[model samples]
Target: MRPRLSLPKPHRRGFLTAAAGLLGVSALGGCERFAASPTGRRALKAGEDANMFVQRLLLTPASLAKEFPDSQISPWFKPNGTIDPPDRAYKALAARSFEGFKLRVDGLVERPQDLSLADLRALPARTQTTRHDCVEGWSAIGKWTGVPLAEVLQRAGLKPNARYIVFHCADTMEYAAADENEEAETDKTANPDMEARPEGAENQASDSQAAGSEAPGAEAEEAQGTPIRYYESIDLTDAYHPQTILAYDLNGKALPVSNGAPLRLRVERQLGYKQTKYVMRVEVTEALKGIGEGGGGYWEDRGYEWYAGI
Candidate 1:
């Protein structure tokens, strides 16, 4: 039998207070008239930048979170969004069980790399079992072990303009029609389905469709190939936090493919989505305004606050 571990009462209270305060701030920032106006937008950006800077300054660099005894580990750690990406490229990777998968680190860096699973495993690793809280109102406790993201960044030689870090993933949340159409056409030509397409045939069809939709102009944005895996970005302050890691192992073993096998971002302070899984590329940039509706992330563009600190 495992011991039932719980968070301290004061810590729980503090978490609630911070969440309420953040919600209030987001509510104020979301007012359309205020957020859309030039003056208001500038003011909001300034305020956000200032708040981030202050938080960075106050952060204790080496301070560690409390680690629990093994008996306290939760038995069931629930999987979050897009548990298995519907994207064909991701499915193919899953088929092989992700044995050949590699994580690429490029953009705004002096040294770009295509690191293999073995390469990542060789890096220094940290293990922690922390409580994961989601904005949708659920919580889970799990043990995660991985290399510190700061170490990976240091090895990459980030350029002076690198102020934000963007994570590109193999998973996607939505499937667009444009992507679907391309797949159908490719499948009809490549593999004729007399009775019905085989599972592999269907996947190939989907991949062809996804590939056909990429505009030539879109290709110029990054050297990487497309369907631009589900991506998210964060400012440098969060990027360098001690708790922010490129997790290669989870719960004391090689991470299962369903749990983002090769590498996953564990930005402990933010919401679950911000911790992107099956990360392929880590791009460091100076601004978020040019990335996806200029809000910060896919969810942030929809209405969720970018700074989901809790």
Candidate 2:
């Protein structure tokens, strides 16, 4: 667990600026070497842990991010990252309006849970209008409503050894159509025989195309490797924050597919990247060593900071 939250000092604003440059170069750069080179690594490197430590030490557990008046909300909250996931299992769930979508919770807990959408909605909910600061230098204020994550953690009963909370998402980093062999190999669990397709289907939630991207139905070729689904983590301190929600609604409406339907993490204090979309599961673990090259997030694996404070 991390310390309580508090305000960052003026000197640390430089860290934020440096992080921006780090992110830009990271976008165009190599693998983990961003932190391992002889020269100072642009990514978090040694400073990553220090950043997390300072944030937790300074920030208060009860401190809240700025909330905007509803009038200030954006006309549209632009969606980034994988807009559509073409995974067959996710398609089926979305087709039925995610009636079958289950947010699986396991790892380092007492009672493991498989919570349905309704199950989650039935819990206590909070709605807040807050700014989403994206790493790409964009910001938007929108009202988000969902259950407080701490409530769920209490329900699950965290074990003594539990430390970091891992979020498994449905969004894939590499957007490529699955080849027949790959599809067939996963068919039994992911694409098993079922009723005819629904009117519309998609999690890696939207195959909705990005600029210069191919259509969903474009032939899936023999790519070098499989797509990597997005995942991220945070210490327990952030998880227990009153404003930390697993949001199902944006601006008083159910989140659209592009905005991480049926659920997404809303750690109000962190940058938008930490608010991973298309969340599928949550895992509690002591250390990050065994997960995704041990960097803590998809981008972190590439050299971005695990603690991307605003």
lDDT of 2 by residue, 1-310 (tens): 3334333443556666656655655676564564466545644454564566567658776789999999999776767665556654565676678988899899998989999989999999999999999887878789999999997888888888888899998755553345645532321211112122233232234433321133233234234236467899988878888999999999987887767889999999888889988899999888999888798998888667788876
Off by over 4 Å in 1: 1-58, 61-63, 176-228
The residue ranges of model 2 lying beyond 4 angstroms of the native Cα positions read 1-39, 175-225
- The residue-by-residue lDDT of candidate 1 on 1-310, one tens digit each, is 1112222223444444455544555778457776677755555555544444444445554444455677777665555454445455555665566778878898888889888777877888778887777776767677899888887888888787677888877664433335434431212211111122222322232332422332223333222223334578876656777788898777786665445656789988777768777788888777887776677776777655677665
Clash count for each candidate, listed in order shown: 2, 16
lDDT for residue 253 in candidate 2, whole number 0-100? 79
Q: What TM-score, over all chains together, does every model reach?
A: 0.68, 0.75
Report the alpha-carbon TM-score of model 1 versus the true structure.
0.68
Instruction: List per-prediction Cα lDDT, in the order shown.
Output: 0.63, 0.73
lDDT of 2 at 111: 86
